[model samples]
Target: MSEHLTIVEHPLVQHKLTLMREKSTSTASFRQLLREISLLLGYEALKDLPLTEIAIDTPLTEMRAPVLAGKKLALISILRAGNGLLDGILELAPAARVGFVGLYRDEATLKPVQYYCKVPADLADRPVLVVDPMLATGNSSAAAVDLLKERGAHDIRFLCLLAAPEGVERMRQAHPDVRIVTAALDEKLNDKGYIVPGLGDAGDRMFGTK
Candidate 1:
């Protein structure tokens, strides 16, 4: 697969994202907006899915119907935050195989440490969409992708609600073949390694956690 980065610029996505970015947006509202925006993001990500024809019965007669080619996709969520994008995408692609990769950054070392990983048995044959709301430092995101790659996931796509330049570059350097899809690409990462003007900690906003 070719390396790509797509910034979704739909009006609806932009509007909901603005509301979510407000400091005063509540957790419930944040979560709701994420679900809605994810639907739009998924649409863009799967725009070019290959199509194949199969025999099918229509209202009047039997005919060949066009359907997605290749095996069903594997939707891999990168722990808690990725769940937000996962849910909406699941609604869009309910037949997709679901999986999760749990990783946390060490406070001192600032490196990702895997805590959990469970994926479909057919992961190697299916294209994978890795979901995470924020791509900040990219260390954890790239690490999660590494785990999937080790499992034989060559066709991988990284999906996020927001992305920082540093994080995008990091992922590009590490996994140039994977496509990166996001609702918005922000300016930069702040001193604390947070996306500047991002929808604050996405997990915190979505789940009301500290």
Candidate 2:
């Protein structure tokens, strides 16, 4: 989590990602793949969580066991496609508090427009992970982070399925302290603000929309 950007290059992650990128992949399969890949990315993203030792009684003996330190984690999904990643991560961290930031791009300007936002209280005390499937233009992701900071979330990390260099740079310039974790870094964004060679529009494919 200390690194500014971490690409999860695990074999399983890459394999499923390949399936997701295929145009002929069915909606059911796409959604399933997203869920599976999410678990892998979630594992990498949460690896650095702080741990503290606590005394516990094992069936055989008493010992100090390590457990997650501090408050429960806060997961803020960036609406729509973010929910796909959120579902699998929830299975991994069922105790985590969940929230959502609703944003959509302005077709002409390619800027984020917030429609809804509701997050857990005391964000300053918990570790926050913002989930989104794609970091295409980075406008929405950066803006989402801005809103979280305004709500007092300092320890924040960003998790995505794919990232474009433009999006990564945008996040770095906008919020250098936040760590970014993704499955892959594609070539570059297309003119229309989509990641080149990405798995199409994540939300569209996952939800079976146009």
Candidate 3:
């Protein structure tokens, strides 16, 4: 989590990502793979969560056991596609507070346009994880972080399925303190601001929409 970016190279994660990337993969299969891979990515993302020990009694003896410390995690999904990643992470951290930021790219400008936003209270007191499947242009991701900061979110992390170098650099420049975790970092983005060699539009694939 200290690094600006962490790529999850677990074999299971990579294998599932390959399946999800295939054009022939069905909507059902893609959605399932995303959920499956998201757990692995979430594992890497949450590895550095602070821990504290507390005394607990075992069947035979009592001992100090470690448990998560500090406030409950706040998970903010960056709209529709982010919801796909959100599901698996929720399964991983069932008690995490949930929020959403709705944004879409303006085709001509390639900038993010926000339409909706609703977040949990006391963001400043909790660690935040922003979920999104693609980090193509980084405009939306950066904008999402901007909104979170406005709401007093300081400790934040970003999780995604795929990232382009351009997007990574963009986030680095915009929010250097926020760590980014992803299943894979592909090549540069296409002219249309889509990650090249990416699994296509994640929202479309996951939802079987055009």
Q: Per-residue lDDT for 76-188 in model 2, tens only?
A: 99989999999999999999999999999998999999999999999999999999999998999999999999999999999999999999999999999999999999999
Instruction: Give each model a TM-score.
Output: 0.95, 0.98, 0.98
RMSD of each: 1.8, 1.2, 1.2
Question: Which candidate order results from sorting by lDDT in descending order?
Answer: 2, 3, 1
Model 2: residues with Cα > 4 Å off, grouped in runs: none
Q: What would the C-alpha RMSD of candidate 1 be, to one decimal place? A: 1.8
Per-residue lDDT over 154-202 for candidate 3, one digit per residue giving the tens place of the 0 to 100 score: 9999999999999999999999999999989999898899998999999
**Candidate 1 lDDT over residue span 12-107, tens digit each:** 999999999999988899999999999999998877667899999889999998998888989999998999999999999999999999998786
Provide the lDDT at 79 for model 2: 89
User: Candidate 3 — number of clashing residue pairs?
Assistant: 0
Candidate 1: residue 134 Cα off by (Å)? 0.6
Q: Which pairs of residues have clashing backbones in candidate 3?
A: none
